[model samples]
Target chain A: MRRLSPPPTSKLVIFVVIAFFLLWWVPFSHVLPEGFPLRFGTYRTFQGSMIAMWAIVALGLNILTGYNGQISLGHSAFVAIGGYTAAILMVDYGWPFWTTIIIGGLIAGGIGFLIGVPALRLTGPYLAIATLGLALATPQILKKYDGLTHGTQGINVRPEVPASPDFIEDWFGIKLSNDEWIYFLALFIALLMLVLALNIVRSRVGRAFVAIRDSEIAAQAMGISVPRYKIIAFGISAFYGGIAGGTYAQVVGYVSPESFNFLLSINFLTTIVVGGLASILGSVLGATGLIVVPELPGIVSFIPGAGLPDELSWAFYGAALILVMIFAPYGLAGLFHRLVRVGPARVAGVLTPVQGAWLSWRERRRAPPASPGQTGAGSEDRSSGDQPGTE
Target chain B: MEEFWQQVVTGIATGSVYGLLALAIVLIYRSTSVLNFAQGEMAMLTTFVAWSILQWGEYWVMFPLVLVIAAGMGAFIERVIIRPVEGAPVLNIIIVTLGMFAILNNVATWRWGGIPKGFPAPPEIEVTGIRFMGEGALDIGPTVVSYHDLTILVFAVAIMVALYVFFQYTPLGLAMRATAQNPVASRLMGIRVGRMLTVGWALSATVGAVAGLLIAPLILLQPPMMMGVLLFAFAAAVLGGLDSPVGAVVGGLIIGVSENLVGTYTPKEWLGPDMKLTVTLLIIVVVLLIRPTGIFGRRAMRRV
Candidate 1:
C-alpha cells in the first residue's frame, strides 16, 4: 500500500534545509513579521532546546530500556551527575564548555559501568527498583557534598560561547539572542548523537545487546560476552544521558539538584514508551510530546478548581500514558512503521465502513451465509477458563 | 552507646512503616511479577480519604471505610489499567505504574491542596502512651529508649506476625500463592486467576494504606508526603528481596535503623540527615552485589 513513501532523497534534503532555516528564525522570533504566533523569541528557543535535550536523554533511555531491556529508572542520576560535573568544572576551574561536556559524559559513563556490574544479576523489575533508589538518592547525595554541589543553591555555568553584544552589526546584522546560539549548539550535538546512536544500534554490538535482552543465557552461550555487552550498553546509554545533561547546563546556564529528579526520569521513560521504543525517530517524537502535552491542561481550565497548569499537568500526562499504552503499546513510531509496512490497502480497508459492509454483503450473497457465532474455524474452540471479571 | 541504642529502637519503629509498605510491594510483585510504582501514591490518596473520614470524627468507621475504598480502588486499577497489558513487556507495566503514580499524586494535590496538614494523631498512641515504651526500653547507660519507638517496633512485629499467619494458615492464602506460582495451572485447577490477582492488588493497597496511615502521624500529611517513604520502602524491598515478605520487613528494619544512626553520627560539616538516603542506596547496591537475589529472595533460574 502507498505510504506517501518518504519523499525522494533529494526532496528530503531540501526539506531539511528548509527546516534549518526555520529553526534559525526561532532566536529572532521577536523581530519577525507582525501577527506571527509563537513569537516568544528566547523563551520559545529555550523550550525548543529543552525538547532537544529531552530527546537526547530519551534516545539514551531507548538504548538501555527499549533495546537492551535493562530498565534504569535512575537515568536522571547519570544526567544529574553529568550536569553537575559540567557546571562545577565550568564554574570553579573555568574549564571550557566542550571539555566539561566530554569529561562529564565520561564520568557519568564510568558510574553507569559500575552500576551495570551489579545490574548484571538483576532482572527487569529488580533493576528498575535499584535504579529507583539511585534516582531518589542522587539529589540528596549532591546536596550532601555541599563543597562541590554548593548545597542546593546549585552551580551556574558561565556560557563559554555567550552571544556577543554588537549592536546587531558584527554577526548577522540582525538581533539574535544567546538562546538561538545555544539552541544550535544543542541541536548540532543532538543530531550528531542521533547519528552516533543510530550507527551504534545498527552495528554488531547492537545485535549483541538485543541478544542479551532476549536471553542472557542464550547470548552468553553464543559467546557474545553478555556481561561485557550489558556494561557497554549501559555505559553508552549513560554517555548519551550525560551529554544531554551537559547540553542542558549549557542551554540553561544553571545546574540544580532539583532539576534532575525522579519525575524527570519518569518523563524520559514516558517519552520512549510513547514515542516508540527501539526506534530512532521515537526519541524526537517523545521529546516533543513531553514539552507539548502539558499545555493540554489549558483546554480544560474552565473546570472549577483546576488549579494552575503545573499542578494539573501530571494527571493529564499520566492519563495519556495509560491510554496510549493500553491501545498502542508499540508507540507512535511502531504504528507508523507498521502502517508503512502493511501499505495503505489494509488501512484503507479498515476505514471506509460503507465499502467494508458492501464488500462483505456482496461476498455473503455470492456464497451461502455461515452459521452465526460459528463462522470461523479458529472460533470453534474457546478456552474453558472463565473470562476476567469485567467489573 | 546509649544514643546508638535509642536510635536503633527509633529506626525499628520507622523501619516498621517501611516494612509494611515493602510488604505491599512484595505482595503485588508476587502476584503480578511487576512493581507497582504507584503503590505509595495510591496509599497516600487513601490515607487522605481516611483523613477526611476522621475529620467527621468517626474513628472506627474510618478504618473499615478506608480499607474498603483502597481495596476497591486497587481492584479497579488491576482490572482496568493493568489487565489489558498483562502480557506486555515489563517496561510497559512500569510505565503504566509510573503514570498512575503521577496521576494519583497530582489528583490528590488537586483535590486536597499541596499544603501540609496536621494528621490527627491516633488515639491509640496517647492511650498506649510513651510511658509504656519507656518501661520496656532497655536502659543502656544514660540512654533510655523512647516508648514511642518501642511501640512502633512492637506494632510492626505484630502486623508482620498477623500477616504471616494469614498467608500460611488460610486456604485463600494458599490459593493466592498457587496463582502467583503458576497462573495457568491455577486457572485449570479451578482457581480464578483474575480474581486472585485483583485480590492481591486490593490486599496490597489496603496494606499500603495502613502504612500511609501510620506514617502520616510521623511526617506531615501532604500530597508529597509519601514520595521519600516510597523510595525507602522500595529500597527495603530490594534489600530484603522483592518477592519475600519477611525479607521486606527485615530489610526495612535494617534500613530504618541505619538511616537514624547515619544521620546522628555523620558530621554536620560532612553529611547530615539530608544525605541519609544515600545509606539506603548503598545498602541496595551492596546487597545486590553480594547476594544478587537479596538474602531472602529465591534465586531465579533462567531458561534459554
Candidate 2:
C-alpha cells in the first residue's frame, strides 16, 4: 500500500527534468524521412499553449470548487478581469508585460475576495446561480465600459518576442515563432503553479479547506474559521484564474468579453472534474481532455470510416460523459490510482477471496449447466459484501 | 401615466414567460436538490423538434406533439445522464449537468444550424384605435393588448394552477414530494422512488417545453434562444424561494415587472439597457444576503 502511492517527489522531479530535455528534440520530428506518418507541427504548439492555459485555470477552480467546497459557474469573469486588466495596461500604459500580469492577478484576487464575503453564507445551488449571473453579466459589463474595454471592438497587443527566442536561435539554430514563445512561457508558468498548488494542497491550509468541504459544521467544531478560510480559498483561486487569463490574452494577442464566456467557464469546470477532483495531476489530465474531446474525430481520422459525423459528435460526447460518470466517478486520476493500488493487491494476495470469487463467477458464466452450485455460492459471497465494488 | 400603465401590462405578460420557466426549475429542485443547468438547452432541443413537426403541417398540432416528445426526452436525460450521478458528490452531479449542457447545445447547433429562423406566432392582436407606447393622449388599458401577450399571460396562469392541483391533490404528486423530502421514507412506504424521479423530470421538461414554444416565436427560433430566458427564470426561482412553487411564480412576476419598470423609469445614463443582466446579479446577491432561503422558501436546519 505504501509503494502504491506515486513515486517519491525527488525521483519524480528527476524524471520530469530528464523529460524536459527530451522535449527539445520533439520540434525536429519534421525532418524524418518521407512516408513516416509522425511529425511535429505549429498547431501542436498552439494546442500545447491551450492545454497549459487551461491547466492553470482548472487548477484555480479545483481549489474553490474541489478543495473549498464552493460552486462557481462564473470564474470566467475573473479570467476576463485579469485579461482586460493586462490588456488595458499594455494597450494604454505601455507597462512591462510581466508586471501587468501580476497587477491583473492582484485585481482579480481582490474582486474574488469581495465576492467571497457575501458568498460565504450561500449554499451550493445559490452560489452556482450567482456565478452564472457573473459569467453572463461580465461580457455585458465589459461592453458597457466602452472607454476602457473598447466596447466589443476589443483590444489587441503588438506581438511579443521573448528572450527565449534569441536563446533558441543561438543554441539550436532554430527560429522561435510567437506560438512557441507563448507555449514555453505558459509551460513555465503552469509548472510553477502546479508546484505551488501541490505544496498548498499538502499544507495545513489545504487540510482546513478539505475539512470545510467535507462537513462545515464538523470543521467549525474543530476550530476552523470556515468563512475566513472560504474567502481565502476564493481569493487564491481567483489569483490563479487571473494569471492564466493574462497569459491567455498574450497567446491570442487580443482581449474581448467574447473570449471568456460561460462556455469557457463550463469547460474549465469540466476539465477539473474529468481530470480528478482534489488532485493536481487531475487538473492536467482534465485540461488535455478539454482540448482533445471536441477534436476526437479529427484525431482519429486516420482510421478508415471511423470519423464521427460533424452533427453526431455532441451525442457521442454526451454518451461518453454519462458513461465516464457512471464508471469513473474519480475521473482519470482515480482510475490511475486504482490500477496501481489494485494491481499490486491482486498479485500480493490482498484480495484473494474477491479475486477467486470473480474468476469462478467468470468460469461459471462460460459453462452454466456444469457450474450452477459453484456460481450460487459465489453469488452468496457477493451478497455478503466481498465483491470489489462493494467498497 | 398611460405609458407607465402600458409598461406595467407589458411587464406581467412578459413576466409570465419567466414564471413558467421558473416553475420548471423549481420542479426539479424540489424533487432533487440538484440544479439542472441544462434545463434551457433541453427545452431548446424540444422546441427545435416542434419546429420540425411544423414542417409537416398545421400550428396547434406542434404543441401537443412537442409536449409528448419533450416528456420522454426529459425522462431519458434523467435516466441516462443524471441518474448515474445520483447520490454521488454534489460537484459530480453538477459536472454531469454541465456536460449535458455542452452536448445539447452542440447537437442543436449541428441539427438546426446557428441561424435564427423567423417563427410565425399564433396570431396578431388586432388593434382598433389605440396608440400608447409612442406618445401623447391615450388610455392605458388592456384594450391595447396583443393576442400573443394574452396567450402568454393565460398559459402561465393555467399551467401554474394545474401544477398546484397536481401536487396538492394527486397521489403521484404526493409520492414525488415524499421522495424529495425523504427517499428512504418514501421507499419504506412502497413508493417507487426511481420512477417518481423520472416522472418529476418528465413533468419539469413538459413545463420547460411550453415556455420554449411560447418564447421561440418571440425570439425567432435559434439554438441559443433560451439562454436569456433561463437566466431570468433562475432569478425568479431564487427570488420567490427556490423550494416553494408559489414563490417561483410570484418571484417570476416581480422580476418581470421590475425589470421593465427599472428600464422604463431610470435614466439611460445611469443604467443602460445592458444593466438588466447586472440587475439580475444584484437581485440574486442582495436577496441571498437578506433572506438566503428567499421569500417563500423555508429555512433549512442543519445538524452536526
Candidate 3:
C-alpha cells in the first residue's frame, strides 16, 4: 500500500505566508465594503485566535492520545498550570508577556514529564483513572495554595499592549485595543505552534508515536523506547496546553480553579473525538464542535418558545457523543474523508440504481461469513472491522 | 487515643460507602473491561428514584423497591448503551461511560433542580447516643464516635456478608464469575455470557444504589454530590485491584483511613477539606507505582 505523501514543503511555506497575510488583513474594517452584513471584524479575529488556541491543545493531545494511545483525563491540569503560571508571573513578578508564556509552557512541560515518568507505566483505563485523579486534584491544590494561586478568588491579568505601531494599525486598521493586541498575539502563537505540530507529526518522532499507538509491545520490539516516547508526547502535549492556557488567561484576563474543572477536560476530549481524533485539520473541527454544539441550544432559544431547557444541552451533548461513537466512530474527519472519496463518483451520476445494487452485493460477498455462535447483530463490529487499514 | 479510635470508626464508615461503589465498579470491570465512570451518577440517579418512591410508599417498601429498580436500570443501560461498545478500544469505552456520566447527571439536574436535597433518616434510627467503646477515656479523644458511625459500620458489614454469600454460594454468581474469567469458553459451555454481563451490571448498580442511599444522609443529596465519591471510589477500585471485589473493600478502608489521617495532620490552609481527594489520588499513584495489581489482587501475567 502506497502511503499518501504530504503536500510539498514549498506549498506549506506559501500556504503559511498567505495565511499570515489573510489573518492580518482580512479582519480589518477598511478591507471590507461598508454595510457588509457578513463582515465580522474584531469578533472574527477573536474567534479565529480562540480556534487557533484550541487547535494547538488538540494537536498536543493528538501526540499523547492519538499517537501514543495513552489516555489522559488530566490534560486540563497542564492547561491550568500554564494559566496559573502566567497569571502569577504577570501579577506577582511583573514578568514580560512573552517571557511569562514561555515560563508557563516550561513549568507545564516539566510537570507533565514528571507525571509521565510514573504514569506511563500504566496503560488503558488505569492511565485514564490516574489522570482523572490528577485533573480533580489540581484545582484543589491550586485552591489550597492561595498565596500563589489566589485560591478560588483567582488572579486578574492585564493584557500586554503591543509596542510596534505599524504592526498594530496594519492588523486592526485602528489603534489596537488591549484585547485586540492580545488576540493577534495569540493568533500568531497558535499559527506558529500549529506549523511546529505539523512538522513534528511529519518527523521521525511522530512515526514512533504512531507505532506506539498501533502497538506498544511491537514498537518496543522494534527498538522504540516506549516510556521515553510516551513522556515526550506528554511533555509536548503539556507545552501546547500551557500555551493555550496562557492565551486563554490573556484573553479572559482571569485565572481560576473553576475555569479548569473536570468538565473542561471532558469538553476537550469531546472536541478531539468529534473533530477527528488523529487528523490535524480535525483538531480545528473538534474545537468548533466543542464551542458550537454547546451553543446550539442558545441559538434554538431565539425561536419563539421553541428552546430546550439549558440542562438539556448537556444531555444532548452526551447523547451526541454516544451517537457519534456508535454511528460515526471515525468522527466528522472520517465523514469528510468518505465524502471526499465518493463525491466525484456521485457527481458523475455513476451511482445508478443497478450500480448501487451491484456494489451492495459485492460488499456483502466480500465480507467474511459470520462464524457459528456469533450473535453479530450490533453495528459496532461492522464499524470496527471496516476501520481503514487495520486488518 | 480516643480521638484516634473515633477517626478509625469514621474512616471505616466512610470506607464502607467507597467499598460498596468500588465493588460495583469491579463487578462491571470483571465482565466488561469497561470502567464505568458514570457509576456514581447512575447510583445517585437511582437513589433519587428511591427518594421519589418514598414519597408514596413506606420506608421499608421503598428500600427494597429502589434496589430492584436500580438493578433493572443497570441491566437496561448495559443492554441499551454499553453492549454496543463491548469490544471497542478501551478509550472509546471510557468516552462512552463519560457520555453516560454527562447524560445521567444532566437528567438528574433537570428533574430535581441543582439545589441540594435533604436525605431522610428513619425515625427509629435517629437515636443520638449509642456508645460503642464505653464512655470514659475513649470518648475524650480527638474525635468522638457517634451512634451514626456504629449504624453505618453494622450496615456495611451486613451488606458485605450478604454479597459474599451471593457471589460464593449462588449458582448465578458462579456462572457470572465463570463468564468473566473466560467469556468464550463459558459460551462454548452453553452459558449465556451476554446475559451474565447484563446481570453483572444489574448487581453492580444495586450495590451502587445501596452506597448512595447509605451516604446520602451524611452528605446532602445533590445532582453533582456523587462526583467526589466517584473519584474516591475509582481510587479505591484501583487500590483494591480492578478485578477483585474483596480488594475493593480493603482498598476503600485504607483510602478512607489515609484520607482522614492526612486531613487531620495537614494544615487547615493547605489541602484542607479538599485533601480527601488529593490524598486518595496520591495513594492511587503510590499503589500503582509499587503494585499495579493492588493489595489482595492476583498478579496478572500480560503477554508481550
Best by DockQ: 1
lDDT of 3 by residue, A1-391 (tens): 1111222243443364347535644655334676776555665565655666676688788777876777888888989988888888888888877888888888899888988898776776677778888888888888887877898998888544234357657775676545456666776787677677777777889888888888888999999999898899888888888988887777777888998987677677767777666666556667757766766787789798887888799998788778777765666555545444334464245678676556545444545575333333322223332242210
Q: Which candidate number maximizes lDDT?
A: 1
Model number with the top TM-score: 2
Show pairs that collide, candidate 2: none
lDDT of 3 by residue, B15-42 (tens): 8788888888988988888888899999
By lDDT: ranked, best first? 1, 2, 3
Docking class of 3: medium
Each predicted model: what fraction of the native A–B Cα contacts (within 8 Å) does it retain? Answer: 0.80, 0.57, 0.60
Q: Cα deviation of B62 in candidate 3 (Å)?
A: 0.2
Which candidate model has the greater DockQ, 2 or 3?
A: 3
Winner on DockQ (1 vs 2): 1
Decreasing DockQ order of the candidates: 1, 3, 2
Off by over 4 Å in 3: A1-48, A159-165, A171-181, A303-307, A344-355, A358-391, B122-144, B267-276
For candidate 2, report its TM-score.
Answer: 0.87
RMSD of 1: 6.3
**Candidate 2 lDDT, tens digit per residue, B27-70?**
99998887777889988999898888889867777778889999
Winner by lDDT between candidate 2 and candidate 1: 1
lDDT tens readout by residue for model 1, A1-391 = 1122341232332344338436645544666766676565566677777887888899888888878888888899989988988888888888878888889899999988988887887876678777877888888887778887897898877545456357544667766667776776788778778777777777888888888777778888889998899999999999988998899899888888899888788778889988878766667767877787777687467687864576778898888888777766777655544454333454334646575455445434544455343332212112111111000
> Is 1 or 3 the stronger prediction by lDDT?
1
Return the clash pairs for model 3, or none: B3-B141, B3-B142, B3-B143
